[model samples]
Structures are given as C-alpha cells and as structure tokens.
Target: MNMIDPWGSSIIDYDKLTEQFGIKPFTDVVDDIPHASKLMTRGIIFGQRDYNKITDALNNNKPFATMTGMMPSGKMHIGHKMVVDQLKWYQEKNADIYVSIADMEAYAARGISKEKSRELALNEYITNYIALGLDVTRDNFHLYLQSENDDVKNLAYIIGKKVTFNQMRSIYGFNNSTNIAHIYTPLLQVADILHPQLKKYGGPKPVIVPVGPDQDPHIRLTRDLASKFNEEYGFIEPSATFHRFMTGLTGEKMSSSKPKSAIYLTDSLKDAVKKVKSAKTGGRESLKEQKELGGMPDKCSIYELLVYHLIDDDKKLEEIRSKCLSGEILCGNCKGCASELITDMFEELDQKREEARKIANTLLK
Candidate 1:
C-alpha cells in the first residue's frame, strides 16, 4: 500500500500514484483544453481527475472555479509559485479564484499560532502571490483565512458528521497517537474545496484544485465527501490537476523548511543567483567525458529551473534541451543563463512586493 502523508515532504513516485490511485494522465485531455498553460503543455501537470469538467467549462465559457490553499507555516518558496501560475491561468479563463489561507491546518499540524499564521499568510505568502502576478484585487478573486470563514468552519463540522475516525485513519495513516486536531484538519480542507459551490457563492459548478502528488489523499477524501453530501449541498465533486514537484537545488524535493534545498521568494537577488549557480547539474565528470557522453538535462536542477519557471517559449526551451543533451552547452553555461534569469525575476518581485504588502494587509480585513 502506498501511503501519502499530506504533511510529509518525502519524494513521491508519480507513476505509482496514477496507476494505483486511478488518476488519469493529464495528456489524455491536454488537447481538449483551450489555451492550456505552459505547465500543462510542458507536461509538468502529470495527472488529473475529472479535468474534463474544467475543459468543458473553458470551451463553453461557462462558470467554473479554481480553488487552492496555503498552509502558512514557513516562507513561500519558488516551488509554491507553480500553484500561483495555475491560478493565474484560471483567472485568465474568467474562472472564480478561491484562495484559502489554512491557518487552522498550520496550527494543527505545525503548532503555529493563529496570529503567527495570519502574519505569515499576509507577509510571506500573499505578498509573494501578488508579486508573482496573481491579481488578488480582481473582483472574482476570493481570499479568506480559514479560521475566520464562518461558512467554511460550519460546513467542516457538518462534513465531519459523515466521516468516521476509521476512514480518516485509513486514508491518512493516522493512529491512536495522532493528535485529534491533526486528524480533523483534512475535513476543513474538504470544506475549503466545496464551499465555493455553496448557494451563496454560486450554484454548483465545476471546481479545480491544482496540487502536487502528495496532496492526492486530500483530493480523494474530498471527492468522496462531496458525493456523500451531494443530496444536501448539491456539491459537484471537485476536479484536481497534479503537477510534478520542482527539483530542489540539491536534487531533493524542494521544501521551504530546508533552506538550502529551495529558493524562497523573499531571498535577496544576489542569494537567488548564488543558489542557481551552485545548484546540482547532470553534467559529466569532465569536459572531455561530457563531449563524449553528453549532458543529461533531465537530471539537472538548473535545467529544471529554466523549464519550470524561467523560459516560456517552447522552441527556445527545446533548443536549450537539445544543446544540453548534445554536449554543446556545459553546466557552467546553463548555470550562467539560469542565474541571470532568476536575478531579473527577483528584481521585479522586489519592487512588486512593496505594493503587494499593502494590498495583502487589507485583504483579510
């Protein structure tokens, strides 16, 4: 049995997740989407469940929504930017955007105080979200702290009525020793996902959650709960798109808690460039060996930085990949390019975050 701990930062085997967990490949429906994001086109979004609903809504110009949450336990990192990118794409499609700050979960799992969670959510997460061009001020964008949302809290209690402790244990690998708060927090997530379909928000419509593979357990539980309560709430089972986690600078899973493994959105431009330059690469041991065997872009963290964030044009991206694989571009050259790109990006973010901080301060009020 493959146990996926939502709170754990271990690496995930995405193939096993799809084959054993019934997540359909995103490529199966890629051509169906209109103006799919680069993440989708580049195959970063690997698996999905019921994404056809979203594609249908996109094609027909019907109402739909995109929902995602942030657990404000640490600084926001570059890996977290992928979620923002997906949300931005949904916004462009005119889908209602729901951003939930999971203060309750942060408290339950990480022992973070509600006040501290709120502070981090606004200053670290939301500020960087705006800096990344999420347009939080848009009329269709709904940002709320979970602890403050009475509707979500109330719905979570009601959701708990239908779920048993045994079910939670089975899905989350919970045991007798697990804290009750930690065990119950996932119900709040279900509420976060389904609350957008409430009558006050709008009648039931398609909703999509973009997440990493580790979050599949939540997606599965939410979908089941949505069906069990469908008669009362008219809930449409939420859809999800699972994206690959960004490779860390040291080639492990990128985690905010591991400062060396990730580049925080708030990092100084010099530090950001330094991290890129020092990142692991898939280069051969020597120039002579590299010329004979070629570089492996697939295993290079610096190459992943370009593919995932820096480069946008497919043709240009392909050229870089081809050069790397053909031994024409060495690790030093790739690192130089990645470092320049990250430096430019951080400089822009530095300016935008000042105004974003002001806007973020007012968002939760």
Candidate 2:
C-alpha cells in the first residue's frame, strides 16, 4: 500500500500504525491488500486509541463512551465532516457517543457574543451534525453544550490544579510572553472529555475519543491527566483515541478560517463549485507542461481529496490514479466532476440537516 506523509512524501512502514499514542489496526485490516493497508493505517492513526481498550470494552459488553467535539466557530465544513464520519463509525460499533457543541470554548477562545455563539452552536452547528447522519435517538448518544453545565467547570478546575504551567507550555507552545489564560485552555478541553458521564452516567467502561490529529495534543494531555486522576481517585477510564487528518484543497492544512481551503457543509452548491474549481492542482504549470511532464497525481490536492473522502470505492481510485499517471485524464475535467459531486453532496446534506434539526429538537428535548 502507498502511504504518504502530510507533505505527500511516501511512508515506508505500516507498523507505524500501532504507535504508543495511536490505534492498533486489526491484522485482517492490513494483510495482503496494499490499498486497504494504507486506509487501515490511516484509520488507526485517525482513531487514535489503544487496541486493547476497545477489545476489552466490547468483550465485556460494556457501554464504552466515545466523544468528539467542535467549537461553534462557523458553519460545519468538510474538514469537520471528516471527524463526524469517524463519530458515525464509532456509533456503528456501539459506542455510547457524546458530542458537545462547545460554545464555552468558543467564548473563551474567540470572545464572540453569547447570542451569536448560541446561534452558531445550537442551530447551525448542532443542526448540521444531526444533518450529517448522527443518530441521537438511540438514547446512547448524549448531545449537550459545555457552557450549560457546572460539572465541566469543576472538572476543569481539578484538571488545572494537576497540570503545570511548564507542561502546558510544552504542549501548547506557551512561553514567558504567553498569557496564563491560554494555559487553561487544555483543562477546559479535558472537561469536555469527562463531562458526559459526570453529568448523566458513570461507569468503569472504556472511553474512546474520535478527533482530527490536530487535536492529538489535547487527547495526549487528557490521557496524562486521566491517569493521574485514576492514581489519585481510583476511578475513571483513560480515553483512548481514533486519529485521522484531512487534506485541504491547497494540499496543506484545512481550516474554516480559510474559507476556500475547506468545503463547508452549509455551502451553497454554487459556492461549493466555485471553491472546487479554484482549488490548487498538482498538475503541471500549463497544459503543455502537463502533457509533456505528466501531473503528480501523488501530490495533487484534488487527487488527495478523492482519496480522503470522495472515492469510497478503492478500486475506482486506483483506476483514476492509473489513468492520471498515464496521461489519460485531464486535471481540469477531473476537478470539474469533483466540483459537481461536492455541490450535489452539500445540497443533499442541507436537506437532511433540516430534517435532522426537527428530530434533534424532539429527541434532545
């Protein structure tokens, strides 16, 4: 299987899938097939967690909790969808899921007005999540906002007492010039992880957190704090992870701050088309150049998008790659197809999201 780093450089070892801080894929997910091996490895890193914890929870028929949260920054983007997909996967695996619309974090981090944050958090953000097929009616999933609860505040206080300024600096790049306020951000995130059970349910079952790799530092810090809490309190299962990262339209980082860099779920079809059409391509500088030098399918942002989200069928992806390398496909036309597909996707998702809002309102209420 072909594996590439974030820079699009080839990765040599599949065993890196089972790192100390990552998920360990099952052998069946990795054996023989090269493409599946690559995805299995991706899934492991993306679903960052200890393999044993997952097995133990499932074996004991325990209702292990899984979590993923998003701050109400703006509309839900495709970058966010990647995490949502992982959450759906965990739900399929019978995880008692907890999703938080972190309005408090948004307030603390962005200093937005409470009304605006609430609008984005409740109507826009939470509505979009259910639109993306999150099944909250199962009763196992808990959907709540962080700002509404005092338990999280208490947990944040306890976690803050345990974590040192030095450790926060190391993880968050805080230094002498850094405000002490930024140092407390990690504790708030930790509170998000443990708040569900503290409020609604508590048990010894394992916990899993599904998030983008950018959130890895938070999980690592939470894991460390949870261990310390276990040693001190004699309870609480350390949260394991399922790690993953999404490729941007620029072949780099995906951020909502860079609107063109990500496809938001709320984007109009025209907006989706425009963004995809203007996306960075890994093709040659010009048609002449592309024809003479054949494009770098391996490094193209468009191709990576297909690999990451669009092309669900692995075999079809291989064919597209083969055609691209053989100069049988044009980058512009391929992107045009991708643009239409994404625009269509957003249209359908928007409809489902409207439906999900009604359901979420009734069920959550």
Candidate 3:
C-alpha cells in the first residue's frame, strides 16, 4: 500500500515512494534551480512537489521562506545533517528561514516531557545546527518551540476543525487505541508549516520544506489545508523537496534510537571513526572475488557517507564511485578515507560546539 509512518523507524523504497505518491522527479526541474546544492544536483534529493514555485522565487528575486522542524526525541545523528545542509543552502540564497522545535509533537509521539525536549533541542540539535553553519542568529531566521508558539497552537486548533478523526486515521494509520494527543499532533505540524505564511510573519510567500520521503503525509495534508484556507488567510501552499535517507552502518536506515545504526553528532571522534570502520561495505567475499567482481558502491554505507557529507567535489566523488565499480578500490581503503574525512570533520565540530552551545542556549528564550 506504500504507507509511510513518519514516527516509525522503517526503510523506504525511494522508487516506490515516487511512483505511488505522485511526487514529481526532482531531476525534472533541477536545472531550473540556480546554483543548485549537491543534494539536488546529485540524486540524493530525488523528488519534489511544486518545487517550481521555489525556483521561480529564487530566479525572480521574490521573497520565499524555508521551514523545517526537529522533533527533539533523541540525539541528532549524521542523517539529520542533510536538513541542516539544506537550511544553509537556503540561507545563502537569501530565503527567510524558520526552524520549529517540534516539542509538542515529541511529547505526544515519543512520551518525552516538554522540559526534556527543550534541553535536547538546545544542547544537541540546535547546537549542531549552528556548528554546521546555519546562521540562526540572522534577522530572517526564526526559531521557536511549538509548545510556546501561541500563533502555531491557535492556528492548529482553528484549522484542525476542517479535518476529522477519519482523515487522521487514514493518513497516519491511527486506530481507536491511538491517543488524542497523537491524533492532534499532525495538525500542529500542519500549522508549523503554514504559519510562516501568516500576515504577522509576512503574508503569503512561497515556503519550502525539505524533508525525507516518509514525511510526505504531512506535506500532502499541509498543502490541502493551505488550499482550503487560501481565501481567509491568503495562504500559498508550501513547496517540498524529498531527499533519500542515509543508510545505517549496518545497512539499515540510520536512526537516532538505534545507536549502532547511527553516528551521533555528539559521538566522540574515536567512536565515530570506529563506527565508520565497522560499517557495512560493498566489497565481495574475498580479495580474489572483489578484484574480479568489483565493489558495489550503490550498496555501501561508506559510499553514502562520502556522497552525503564527506565528499563534496562531484568529480572526485565520481572517481571514487568509478573505482569502486571497476574493482580498482577496495572496502578497507574506502573505510580509511572515510575515517580520515570524518576525523577532520568531527575535530572541527568539537572545536566549535562549545560556542555553538552558548549560542543555542541564548536562542528560543
């Protein structure tokens, strides 16, 4: 049925998601973007919904905003870096940035307390976000806790009247056993997306939410609600671009709850390097077999780390990929390279995190 639960930890078939969900191929309009990010140019960001609106805004120098949220239920992992990278790209493009700390959703879906959510959001997620180069201090940047934003809460309550229990059930697979808070949380997310379009925040501008494909349900719902309230609020439906998930070290979807599946941003450099070395690779059963059959970069978690974060040069990435496919490179060598790159990255992040933490603490105050 191609069902996707945003709260669930499941691996997704990207091709099936695009085919079943009516998400247009990002490649269809990638050329339309000016100075497209590597995520877009590469196949990492594979699908889109009305992304043309965003490119149009970028091209014409019109105002548009990018909104994304972090549900602070667990440690921020390397997989989460993709969103921060997108935010940095938008910031460079001069798009207004809105970051929502989805504390309410965290409490409802994860059984986390609001205080705990705030602590994790500030210390873990927001700190890494700043360290990763998103200028949260910019005037155009707006960061807020969902539980604290009255505008978001009120709008969610009012707009939620148009929705029903049946719709929530159908979208989220909620049954009678599902709690009321969990049922209402998606509405708050809908509000989180559409709130940036409200008159108080500068009315009716195109907004883009970069997300993983699993979050498609929320995007679809938010777009529908935006249309229904267009006359009343001058709401322009938000645009979205979907990126592929990073594979875990064990070849599953990388997740915060699964320690071995992820390299947490807070992980020590020694631990991060160890994890990279232990990661599943595309090498064959033996040296003889690998040399003859070549490696499968497509199946390697190490290759993904390179493509997604470590290696930014398209030519260099391609060279590595070609060598792997040609059996010119082996898994051990790739792991070593990846380890060095990660070491350099973590070293820099470690240095900046103290200042980043101080800055993060000052935010959402």
Candidate 4:
C-alpha cells in the first residue's frame, strides 16, 4: 500500500510494497553482496530488484557502476543524506559512481529556473554529497546535469522510442493533468539509469541505483526497457535498493517546502536543535503515563532519526529502543540527546561542505 510518485514524496509502507510489488527482500541477497551496509542489515534498505548482478560483478572482479540522480529544488536534507550515504558505500567498493543533477525535472515539476536549479545542484546538493563522504576524485566518478549531458539526451531519445504513452500512464499514474515534459522526463530518467552501460561509459555492465522507494517506478520502467532494448538485453537492467522515507517533524511527510518538517543539512546549529526538540513522538500524553504504559518507539519520529540518520551502531540503537519501550527514556530527554547528536553531525558536515565548495568546479560538468 505504498503510494509512490517520482514527482512527489510520500511516507511508504515498506513491507506492503514488498509483498504487493514482488520486490525481493534485501535479506534474500544479503549474504551474497559482501560488506553489506548497515542500511541493508537493519532493513533501511528493505527491497531490491536484480541486486544479484552487483554481487556477481563483485565476486567475479568485474566492473559495476552505481548512479543516483538528484532534483535540485531545495536544500539537501536528512532524507537526501540517506542516498549519499549509500553512494559512499558503493564508492568504497570501487563501483564507478555517476551522480546526475535532474535540472530538467526541477524545471518541469517545480517551474524552477535552470540557473537556480544549477546553483542549487552544485552549491547545495553536491556539496553535501562530498561532505557526507562521496568519493569525487576517482577517475571513473562523474557528475553531470541532464541538460548538459548529450549522451544521456541522446540515449533518452533512443529509449523513448521503446516506450509508449500508455505505458507511462500506467506506471506513473499520469493523465490529462500531467505536463508533456513531465511525461517525457521518465524517458530521460530511464536513459540516466541505462546510459552507464553504453559503450562509452563502460559497455553493458551492471549498475546499482540506491534510492527511496518513491523512485522505483523509474527503475521498473528502466528495467523493462533494458530487457527490450536488444536481442541479448544489451543493457543490463539497473538494479535498485529501496529505503524508507523520513517523516516530518510533525509526523507529516518530510518536505523541502515545509521547512519545519525536515532538518536541512544547511540548517544552522541552533535551528537544527530546535527542529529536533519540536519533532513528533509516539509517547504517551504525559511522562507519568509514559512510565505506566511504556513508549511507542515504532511510531516516533525521534526513533526514526536514530534508525535512518543520527545513530550508527546497532547495539547503541537497540539500547535506545529498549529504554523507550521500557519507559526509562522520556520524550523531553530523548529530544535533548537527539539534538546534541544532530548538532555535532551538522557542525562537522558544515565544515566539510566548506571544503567541498572548493572543489565544486572540479566535480560539476
């Protein structure tokens, strides 16, 4: 029962999507991919399609690529951080990393100017990407905007011929209200996913797309295209791993437009702390009631913060969860602790972001 839209974000029920959509659970292939990420181990990366190809490539010592696109409509937030964290993992494994700035998408979807989109892509998103530990110096690493990439544009035209409006409508839930360019953006995205397999990029190798489940429609389409493109399925269907979304402070969807709902990486230390304090929790109405009835960590945004971003160690996260469920940790105290953890992370990232700024031109195309 997950509601997914590439143009919009929603809180997804990961388990429901897995059952209904036939997306294999990560645990099914965990032992196959060496050095599986904590996200994979902890169910943050809950689902996958053709991830076995990546494991095959790794074990065979064959080259593989990883690509993820960013729409530069707002400041990079914790939700976006999750993707970059996965990118770092792939980079460490020596996967050729390709990051795309979806400027054309921001324009069609949000009516953002190309100039503004480009600015946000570099100054905001890419900076945070490097700050979060993505390896940009590698020879195979490439960062480019959809508008400036001729190879992707050309590939989109080729891929578009293989798809029809009927298919788009079915997969994307599009109709009369959708703009023509918006409808066409999916082909561009399919090209983004498939182009890494093109002869120039490194012919027909496996590629991994680490994303939130909201973007799976694009993956579904691209995978379908990969099989149909050639007699031998010349392009490898790009594999995908899905993560759950981080909810807003008030328990709504974490949206860039709703500043109070998310903690942006660019947020000042004081503001980030305030956001943590204001976040929603699923505890009882009163501290006394919490102790009597125990807390609902399953429904708390604070707990999600630890699971998705703030905390790293499994033992530490379990300890926090146990304390909450036993009513030994209350909302006020939990918020304070989360605030400190978030503050420290942001302070370090903000500084690294400054360092990242120095290499913007070096990375951007």
Candidate 5:
C-alpha cells in the first residue's frame, strides 16, 4: 500500500483512502467518483488550494509560467513520463514552460561523481524530454541546467534572506538534530520556483507544476516562501498541481533503483516482461479461494500500473477488474498481459528516444 508523508496534510493515503469510497483497488478510482475530476483533477493542488482565489488570476491571463525538472540520477522511467505528460498539458493550456535539468540538486542529494554525473544527467534528460515531445523553438520553451544559470543563484540568495533558520526547520522538520545543509537545501528548490522570470515575466503569474506527491515538501516550501515574498515585495504568483502518487509493481512508491517497482523507458522487452510477471499481487493463492473471496484490485500493484499508466480506456479497465475479482482471469496471466502491453509501449518510446537525442544535442549546444 502507498503511504502518505505525515507532514504533508494535503496528501491522501491513496491505497488506504480509496477503500472508504467503495472504490475497489485495481479499478479506476478516478472514474468511479463523478465530481472527482474537479476535486481530484491533475492540476488541483493537493493541499491548501484556494481555487476561487486562483481562478481569477488564471482568467485574467496575467503573464504566467509553468516549471518542472528532473534530476539525472539514473535512466528516465515511465514515472518520469507521468510528469512530462502533465507538463505538456499545461503547455497546451498556454503556460510558458521552463524545464530544468537539475544537476546541482542531484549532486546535493546523491553525492555522485559531480562532474561526470552532471554531464550524464544533462544529456539523458535533454534527450528524453525532447523525445517526449517538447519543442524548444516552436513552443518557446526554456531548457537549461540549474547550476549553469546565474539567475537561479541570485534568486536563491534573495529568497534565503527572507527565510529564517527557525522557519526552515519548521517547514522541513529539521531541528537541532538535523544537519545544517539539509535545512538550507530546500531553499534552492524554493528559488527554482521564483527566480529567472522576474525581469522577463515581470509579475505574479500562475505556475502549475506536475510532480509526484513525495516532492510535496518542495512545493509546500516554495509556496510558503512565495507568499512571504509576495506580501513583502509584491512579486510573482505561485501555484502548482500535485499529481497523485503512483506506486511501482511491488506496491510501493515507484523508485528507479528497484527495477521491479518501475518500468524504465529504456528497458528492453525481456526485462519488462520479467519484472511485471514477477510483481507482487493482492489476489488469492488458489482459484477456489479467489472464487469465494474477491481479489483486492485496489492493492494489486500490477493492476494499478495497467489502470493509471497503460490502459487508456475506462470500459476495458473495469472489465479487467471484474474479471480479476471474479476469478475469471488468473494473476499470472493478468500480469503477463500487462507486461506485454507495457513492453510494446516502451518499444515505441525507445524509437522516439533516438529521434529526441538528435534534437536535444542541437538545443543543448
């Protein structure tokens, strides 16, 4: 089951909470609830969203920008696809896009070989992001590495001046017990939200970010700092959409390190098939047991992948859930079908990745 960050109030424990609404697991929870689209839409802020207040800003069309980034710690995965798809949606809705390759953040977090990792991260991110259909020239998108941008540094310093050690500690849960570096690093993230646009974009504009729930800390910190800065200096508007968390095949939050939990876009058909076939499930052990006791589609990680990431049709997803719960489809075969579907999807994505590499080289240069 997916867990919520205790400090994050807006985060709903999905695997647990979905049970309350009779929205069985492995079913399309989003589709079952009628008004859920509004309350639980892709861009709705997970916590503390003042929608009535923000709508005026959005309607006014006051210069707005959307930003999202990736840390090139490893190969890009379908988990990354979730956010990139969200970014493209916002761009289509008319937000100026600023995508960052977060080299500095990776160095701060991972302690990898700084220079080498930085280069790899940049190349990998540029290639994949462009492959995912980001058009730099046509869309007027800004693609840059975080460390290379002096503007980001200046913004970090400016934002830091307003934030006190106490405030940072409270927001980040840092204490006398925590490291000083950890307390301060979130500020760079806050700066990432606010800087690089004041001179160009000029004033408060709606910035929607499509990010997983774990990084809610970054969004929360950025929103708090932006509000403080706005009250003091009357600066840019800060807004974001917290996409619901997605779990890996093992029923935990998707992590690149655990190959079983996530499907990397670069994974070969064989690897994809092996991982999905072996993924954990929430079904009964025997056919007789499944017939008597319905399978828990809600808790099945493989089912969740098919619903959220693979199958696009609402009707078909429901049919699969009913089949699983009723013992019509065995878990092994169900997993095999999902694995094959995902493998096919990635095979197409890999071809596009090659095309993206060629274009990304030109843009990065």
Candidate 6:
C-alpha cells in the first residue's frame, strides 16, 4: 500500500490505493453524469465511494450537500484548485455547499496563530476560491472556521466519544509524539463531513466530499462513525470522490511548506513561468534521442499541468499528449507551452483574486 498520510506528504500509487480502499472507478458512472467536469472526463477524479447517493440527488433532484474544508495553512497552489473546481461543479448542480476553515487544526498542528489563520483563510484561500468560479453567494453556501463554530466544536467533542485512541493510532499512524489535537483532528473532520446532515439543515441527506486520496482514511473513519450518528441523530453516511495528487514541479508530492514545489495561484507570472521551466520532464537526455524515442507524458510534471489544469479542452489535451508520445513535442517546446498557459492563467487569477477579496465577506456566513 502507498503510504497515504493526510498530514504528511506522499507520492501515491493510485492503482494499489483504488483496490485497497475499495473505491469504485469513476468511469463506471461517467456516462451518467450530466456534462461531466473536465477532471472527471480526464479521469483525474478517479474513484468513488457510494456515489449513487450523489447521482440520486442529481438525477432525482433531491437535496444533497457538498462539504469540504481548507486548513488555512498558507497560500493555495494550483493543486488545491482541483477541489475548488469540483466544488463549483457541485454548486452548479444546486447542491448546498459547506466549507470549513480549519483554524484549530492549523494552530494545533502547525503552530499557526489564529490571526494568521484568519488571514490565510480569507485573503489567501477563500478569496482564491471565489476567484475560481465557485458561487459563494448567499442562500446556497456557508463557511465556518473550526475554532469559531461552537456546534462544530461540540460535535467534535461528541464524535470523539466513539473513536478510541488505539483506533486513532492505527488510522493516522500516530506515535507517542503525536499531540492530542493532532489525534483529535480526524475526529474533527468526521464532524466537518457529517454535520451538514444534522437535523437543523434538512436532516440526513447524502453529502459528497471531494478530496485527494490522502484523505481517504478520514472518509473511512467518518463512514464507520456516521453509523453511530445515524442510529441516534439521523446523520447520513457521507460519500466521497477522490482525485490524484498533483506531483510537484520539482518532481515529488506538492507541499505548501515547499514553495518551489508548487505554483501558487497568487504568484507573479514570472515566478510561475520560472517554476514551470524548472519542472521535471520525461524527455530523453538529448534532443536527438527525444525526437527519436518520444517523451513520457505520464512522468512529466509540465504535461500533467496541461492535462490537470491548463488545457481544459479534451481535443487540445489529446493533441498535446499524442505529440509528446510520438516525439513531436520535445521537453523544451512542451514546457514552453505549459509555461505560456500557466502564466496566462496566473495573470487572470491575480485579477480575480483582487476582485474576489473585495466581496469575499459576502461569501462567508
């Protein structure tokens, strides 16, 4: 099994993960999803757990909630944009949206102050979310900070009752050095994922959580614990969609703490282009060999940017992939294309981020 740690960095083996986690392939339902998002069409949104509930909600026009959160640790990169993209899709489907700002987790785990957490949550993260086309407008959306929401905190304390320290130790790989807050966080997330199903908010409807595969452990824990909630409070068991992690430009797991590994949405165009040019590629050592043997798009970070972020058109992505596989696209040329796309994207997002910051308060509950 790939070492998947929600708090730690890992380059996962998605195949082994799908099989082990019992996640159904997203392709199985692609034909049914109405105008499937680019990520789902591209298979980046790869796996699912009991997604029929979401499909039922979509098809039958039933009430379902889309729930996920950000921890406000730092500036969000394009990797974080994956979740925002899906959030927008679910929002368009009229699913009620709930976002949690994990100020408590950031403070407890990373020693980030509440002041800094609020800054990052609003200016850095939430503004970027608004910039990403998520309709954060009233009526449908709500945002809460973990440290601020008394109900969420109380729910966390209540849910903590069913989870054992030994269970936490095994699921999170918590050692003797792990603090109580760190142990409590998975339980906190369980509350975050399930709270939308509480009676006050329409009661026991299906909820969909879109997350990176690293967070699967929390989903599994939530699944088990939600049954306890169901028996008492009528909380619905949650369903989740998993996407692959975006490998860093330097060729590893993308991390917020490692600045060079990612291209922040707020980065200047020059810095973003520089990061792209420095990215790892699957090209041969020489132009001669690359032209003869072709490139490996699967291992190339720049190519992944085209597939996962930059190029939304399936036809355009396919053209790039075919050229790379057939030696027509050299690493230099491919990186240039990716850099151009990324630079243009950063310029647009920078403007939107500024605009988003202006009305971002309206988005928050």
Off by over 4 Å in 3: none
lDDT of 5 by residue, 93-142 (tens): 55688877766666666655556555665567667666777666655488
Determine the C-alpha RMSD for candidate 4 after optimal superposition of all C-alphas: 1.6
Candidate 2 lDDT (Cα, 0 to 1): 0.66
Badly placed stretches (over 4 Å) of model 6 are: 361-365
Model 1 residue 172 CA deviation (Å) reads 0.3
In terms of lDDT, the poorest run of 10 residues in model 3 is 1-10
Error of 5 at 235 (Å): 2.5
Tell me the TM-score of model 5: 0.81
How much is the lDDT of residue 67 in candidate 2? 74
Off by over 4 Å in 4: 1-3
Stretches off by above 4 angstroms in model 2 are 1-47, 58-61, 175-181, 196-200, 235-244, 360-365
Could you tell which candidate, 2 or 6, scores higher by lDDT? 6
Residues 191-236 of candidate 3: C-alpha lDDT, one tens digit per residue: 9999999889989999999999999999999999999999999999
- As a TM-score, model 4 comes out at 0.96
Residue pairs with clashing backbones, model 4? none
TM-score, prediction 2:
0.82
Clashes of 3: 0
Instruction: Compare candidates 3 and 6 on lDDT and give the better one.
Output: 3
Model 2 clashing-pair count: 11
Q: Which lDDT values do the candidates have, in the order given?
A: 0.93, 0.66, 0.94, 0.86, 0.65, 0.86
Q: If ranked by lDDT, best first, what sequence of candidates would result? A: 3, 1, 6, 4, 2, 5
Measured on C-alpha atoms, candidate 3 has an lDDT of 0.94
Q: How far is candidate 5 from the true structure (C-alpha RMSD, Å)?
A: 5.5
